[model samples]
Target: GAGVSQSPSNKVTEKGKDVELRCDPISGHTALYWYRQSLGQGLEFLIYFQGNSAPDKSGLPSDRFSAERTGGSVSTLTIQRTQQEDSAVYLCASSLVAAYTDTQYFGPGTRLTVL
Candidate 1:
């Protein structure tokens, strides 16, 4: 795919269940970002991986959420204990450079539902 791609376009999970959302950034992109937004809320930054260095996880909402980028390309977001509040649209974006000024290409996002 030319653009960022996310798996399980929609997910329905029970409370306390774990969920793994996958994201494949554009080829050759050096930066990948993860974000989630609840209904009527703005996108909330979750994590980001730049190159082979450490990811900035400052934006994560809690310890239950974590993400990793393998081979500097594919990325996965893991939610340890799903909660109703965790329901949101998980979005992935990639940019050639990891900078605020770089244009980010975004995926359609994975819609999560918790019950």
Candidate 2:
């Protein structure tokens, strides 16, 4: 594909369960980002990866949430001990670089529902 792609466009999980979301950024793009959108709130930056190295993971809500980029390409977000508050739209974005330039191209997003 020419743009960012995400797996499991929608997910439904029970509280206390675990879920893993995947994202595949555009080829050659070294900068990738994860964002969460909850009701009434704008996109919340979850993490950012610059060439397989996450320089800023401070956006992650808690230790239960984690992400990793491999080979500077594919990335995965894992949420353990799922909570209802964790249910939201998970978005993935990518760009040439993520310093101060480059527009981020976002995927369709995966709507997670934690019941």
Candidate 3:
């Protein structure tokens, strides 16, 4: 399989709306991550998944943000009641294994806008 891929590379939504971002990790990768990058800022970790166990979701900004990985392959990040502050590029990455030193392959990211 190819590197991580995200759909709807760009999105625009009005305030209070909901949006879902998708991520497809590389085949056989056991660790997947989701991040958010604001304009001119570094990536901020949002959530992480390893195998099929519970996900590490401590980085989510608020209750409105959540994510899930199904079948240890594809993942989805959902933002409910979008706000202008939620506008940013959502990035996804995958690693061959779960290790602090593992190299992560990243997706291009989905740009979301809240109007």
Candidate 4:
């Protein structure tokens, strides 16, 4: 992809439902990250993936939120049994590499709303 791309710029679902968000990162990038931003809140790091190392899923709010990066390119974020409090923007970012100087490019993000 030319840049990070995220699908379903907006999503509205009832509480207790599940939703899947997709992200397509720039080609050849070796590092990908997912973050969440609740209304009036700052960015919250959700996960990080680089090469074959173990993914850093430490930031996931709970087991209800999960993600996977495949082939080092595309990624998906799934939120199960969503709650009204889950409403927020899910952002995806990618860097050419995970070095200290690497700049992460961000996607437009998916605005998820659990009604």
Candidate 5:
């Protein structure tokens, strides 16, 4: 059984470049989430997807950040006109259910570095 996984373990981009991070959730998991973590900072929820419902984007920092989950499986997080402040580790997690008490499995994350 595979857990959540992300691609491009590391990314380096200029201050104004855009980047897309990908995630693959475990099989049969119905809930997926995106988070961002800065150095020495805790994980900050960015978006969430449950089944076929609309994603929760309230945690997105600004208009430059967005995400989408396709077929209730794979998810992608895109950052437009990236800024230095956006440099951090982008993490993905998936759970069996959408409840707050459900157990979530996390991916290794993609480290984004803005120069």
Candidate 6:
């Protein structure tokens, strides 16, 4: 892909339903990241993956949230039993370099709404 690609640009679900968001990263990129942005909460890192290294999943809010990256490429984020507080935009990014300071290219996020 030229840049990251995210599916279902907008999703509206009743509270308690589960939702799955997908991300397709740029070609040859080795690092991928997931983030969430809310009304006032700026971008919050959700997870980080670099090649075969252990992923950083410390940012996930609860057991209801999970993600996985396969073959160092595509990734999926699943939220189970979504709540009203979970309504926000889920963003995905990728970078060629795997460092704290590396610049990442972001995808048009999947907007999740729980009502």
Scored by lDDT, the top model is 2
Question: Candidate 5: TM-score?
Answer: 0.96
Off-target runs (Cα >4 Å) in candidate 6 are 52-54
Candidate 3, 1-115: lDDT as tens digits: 5789998899999999999999999999999999999999999998888976545778999999988888989999999999999999999999988798999999999999999
Residues 31-88, model 4: lDDT tens digits: 9899999999999999888953435778999999988877778888999999998999
Candidate 3 collision pairs: none
How well is each residue in 1-115 modelled by candidate 6, as lDDT tens digits? Answer: 3889999899999999999999999999899899999988899999888873535789999999999888888888999999999999999999997787878999999999999
Clashing pairs in 4: none
CA RMSD (A), model 3: 1.0
Task: Quote the positional error of residue 68 for candidate 4 in Å.
Answer: 0.6
Could you give candidate 5's per-residue lDDT for residues 16-75 as a string of tens digits?
998999999999999998899999999999888897564577999999998888898899
RMSD of each: 1.1, 0.8, 1.0, 1.3, 1.0, 1.4
Tens-place lDDT per residue, model 2, 9-107, is 999999999999999999999999999999778999999999989999999999999999999999999999999999999999999998686999999
In angstroms, the error of model 4 at 100 is 1.4
Q: So what's the TM-score on candidate 4?
A: 0.94
Global local distance difference test of model 6: 0.91
lDDT of 1 by residue, 18-58 (tens): 99999999999999999998999999998888975545889
Query: Where does model 3 exceed 4 Å of error?
Result: none
Quantify all predictions' global Cα lDDT against the true fold: 0.92, 0.96, 0.92, 0.90, 0.92, 0.91
The lDDT, on a scale of 0 to 1, for candidate 5 is 0.92
Q: List candidate 1 stretches off by more than 4 Å.
A: none
- Model 2 lDDT-worst window of ten: 94-103
What TM-score would each prediction reach against the true structure?
A: 0.96, 0.97, 0.95, 0.94, 0.96, 0.93
The true-versus-predicted C-alpha distance at residue 87 of model 2, in Å, is: 0.6
